[model samples]
Target: MTKLNCPFCYNTIRRRSELHFMCRGRPTGARPACQPELDQVRSNLTGFKEATLPTFEAVSENLMLPFTKAHCPKCGGETTTRACSHCHTRLPMEFGLDASPMVAMVGARGTGKTVYLTVLSNELQKPKIRSEFAATVRPIGEGQDGFGAQDQWVRESIHQVYEDRKLFSTTAQAVDGRKAPIVLEWRGRHNRRFVLRKFRTNYLSFYDTAGEDLTADDVTFKLHYLRAADYLILLLDPFQLPEVQRLLRLPPAALLHVREGKPPIDVLARVTEALKQGDHWNGRHITVPVAVAFAKMDAFNQHLPETHPLRARRRTLGGYDEKTGRIIHEEMKSLLHEWGGDEIDAHLSGHYRSYQYFAVSALGAEPDYENYLVNPRGVRPDRVEEPLLWLMHKGGLVPRAAS
Candidate 1:
């Protein structure tokens, strides 16, 4: 029994000890179907108003070993469906049995966090990447092999980014019900020679908060998930770099996308402070691994030398490459120094015990900002999944490259 924070509500709980379940709703002559009710706890946390299947705690005899399947208190029907104790969102059947790593994504406004998240999720579903990583990124809501998630938050995101070939609207603030963490099941095959092939399934909970939500100290501190996160994806806007912004000249329309906010280092400091606000951290350097990525690389890649490490593809194969990972880490660190963002590298080094730098472009090419459409070349994603792949490698969800 391991303890984990519920991805939806961000509350810590022992997996088996705090179990709650939902009714399957199969009506029988003996027991009628359960009625839907307004779950206030769920409505408050998720902003979902619609009444749903009744959820109840399982009554069991043994405290050491809890019941996996029990007769529903409401319907008298046997059900195994699990729900989070705090938020009541449906948990996957495999959730309590496996490791569900929380990856908290945060950055300032105008960093293109939504676009990057959309493209990254779309890229991870491609066959080439799937074959290489020996895994599939499936939405937790879908809970099936064929159709996509029933949650419109994801359906609409995919439609806007992949189907319509346009950038999706900015992610709504944390209070907005339309925004939810794109919870996923990273199911994979752990193949090893001279051994049994194991089913290695892991959960990935990515909550992409609105940039404005993290700008103020009070608001950022209230987001306790930052402290509970197993990993952090800190996205930085390239245009915010004074040196980089002045060096590149863009059309008037594209300029509309840039907006001023706290500096990148200042944003990192706020997040680091939030992580320290926890009981255990005490303002000391935290051990959580961070993947600090500069999103929208298209703005910089075109002007930099073609051979620059950031512009070149570092990951083209299946497993994680430690050698290339380090190379790019250093390359991006130096590039930051050149862009007058050395304080960012220093701040990360001082605050986080482990951190890596990456350059990712959700759209491989810059979009037509005025028309709200992708480039004429379409949304060709460049290394959008590299940060996640590296994080996966760190978690042992994927293998280390063999020489």
Candidate 2:
């Protein structure tokens, strides 16, 4: 009996023995068709107010019994689509029964969370990344072959950034305005114990939010997912750092796109405060593994030499490279102190039991600010895959040695 958290609702899911199912819809061998109706619970949690397949709960008298399958009461057909008992949001059974780690993506506005996430998902599915891990990636949501809201939302976001050359505009506050999460199953012959299991399939969920959503006391309960996360990917925009600001000679148009906000330390402190309020980490130090990444490293290219680890173009990482990971981690740490962000590193050291720093650029080159488009050289993603990969390594989904 694995205890899992609903990535969408942040509610504890009693898996295997207690099961919830949603109708697949339509008639089935004498079974009635399920009509789409308003699922208020899901709507309240996800802001997905549109009518959806109804979900119902079932529990076995025998606690040890594996209650894997259920029939829709409205329809007599066997339904395999499982949903959260609390919010009625459909979730993959792979995660429900297997207990998977959840990673929350956090960053202030202008950190390019949307852009980085888009590129990361794209890179994971590309041949370069897929072949290295011997992995298969599939988005898990309504419909088949990556259909439904999750796939469509990611598709559109990817198209906008990679094809249209325009970055995602500032995210709007509220559940409805945020980007739908990138949820999927990462099945592969990877993981540290691959020699034993031979293969492992992991269901991963990446959740992001508008910068405005963090640090507010009012949102403490509304954003409970942060506390429930097993791992976190914290992104920091170098442009926001005062030291970077004083040094960079960015164009006025580029500066216009930057969101005015507090230093990264304030963001980290507020998140720490919120985690303290949670039941799990009510202490000074938190146990969640965090990948603290400095996004948009391209903005500082002129300041760095070719030998800088951040500028090294990666061809393919057949697997997680611990040596390279360590080099970049230390480089970012030293750079933080140089940029007056040692406080950010200090806060993590004092408050986090485990964390790693990284330097990444979603777009390998700075976008043409005056033209309001991606770099003319196009969207050359650089090291956008490291943060999530590190979290995956911690989750035991991928091996530590690069092949």
Candidate 3:
């Protein structure tokens, strides 16, 4: 019988012999001999034999056993595993580079993260940016053809910028479709190069999960990627300021649950909960800095509350600016310090020991869909350079340029 224990709860997955699975193994239960105590459970069952092992050759087929339903300890909901919507599977570890600086993105839906990624990847292809940054861009794990499929869908969904440029494409739509893993290699001007290989490339890993999946109680993907990140770029929508205030106060009116949208705090809570539940996260203190980018700042800066003096520092609400960047960073840190993120920061400080902040706008101007034509041209991406610059500096991938 396949008897595998729940890594999070450490409870033997109560299963009967009639269950269709073979025994994976049980926890030792003495004391976690390692920092990530939960990961101590054995995952490699290479030679273990079973009386009735299913003959399916693929790992995906093997996961569908009768007693394999993972339960969320919090709400007891069937734990949902995180996977690429395009590929319907956990991204292959081979797609990751061993020495690349690992950066991760976190944000609410429609905060322009996907679009930003499309633009950033496309921009990296440019010689000015690529050469200036001393970085080479390529798909690490997923091959060109595999990633090509995903990009095709993305290019087709939104209008294109270059009629012949083909825009950006990804390979996530196959049943076993490959997810194109993008790797960025930063070669500093000083001829020193850093190939951040942990997640397998000097590039950032963009994580996009459906909002519904993130909110569920039994999230199986929790803690898996937390340790993979060296920095986190968290996007925010400035238009949701009112909702943020309500969440902070826990007012009864806010409890009514606005139908049109969800609050950031809820998402933040889910993320933190996932981090706390992970069995493998090294807990080395996330040396990564978190940028709470108030995306679409252009659309909502004038609406800031009078009590929030930070509004006066705005330099064109929706546009990106370096001066405004410094202000938002300070304000965000202050807000986090007040909201108990300081404790999290203190924990990370012990590990990463160094970090910084920035604000950015991927699109400089709004799309003119006057004709309903896709690929509306004239994409003026502003300060799209800031975040990468920050990551490179912090990762020690670059040296201070001589004056």
lDDT of each: 0.75, 0.74, 0.41
At residue 35, candidate 3 shows an lDDT of: 17
Q: Rank the candidates by TM-score, best first.
A: 1, 2, 3
Q: What is the lDDT of residue 203 in candidate 1?
A: 73
- lDDT score of residue 106 within candidate 3: 58
Worst 10 residues of 2 by lDDT: 138-147
Candidate 1 positional error at 91, Å: 1.1
Q: What residue runs in model 1 are displaced by over 4 Å at the alpha carbon? A: 61-66, 143-150, 176-179, 191-197, 252-258, 279-283
Question: What's the distance in Å from true for residue 246, model 3?
Answer: 13
lDDT of 2 at 53: 85
Q: In candidate 1, which residue pairs clash?
A: none
Q: Model 2's lDDT to the true fold?
A: 0.74
- TM-score between candidate 3 and the true structure: 0.51
- Cα RMSD for candidates in order: 3.1, 3.1, 15.5
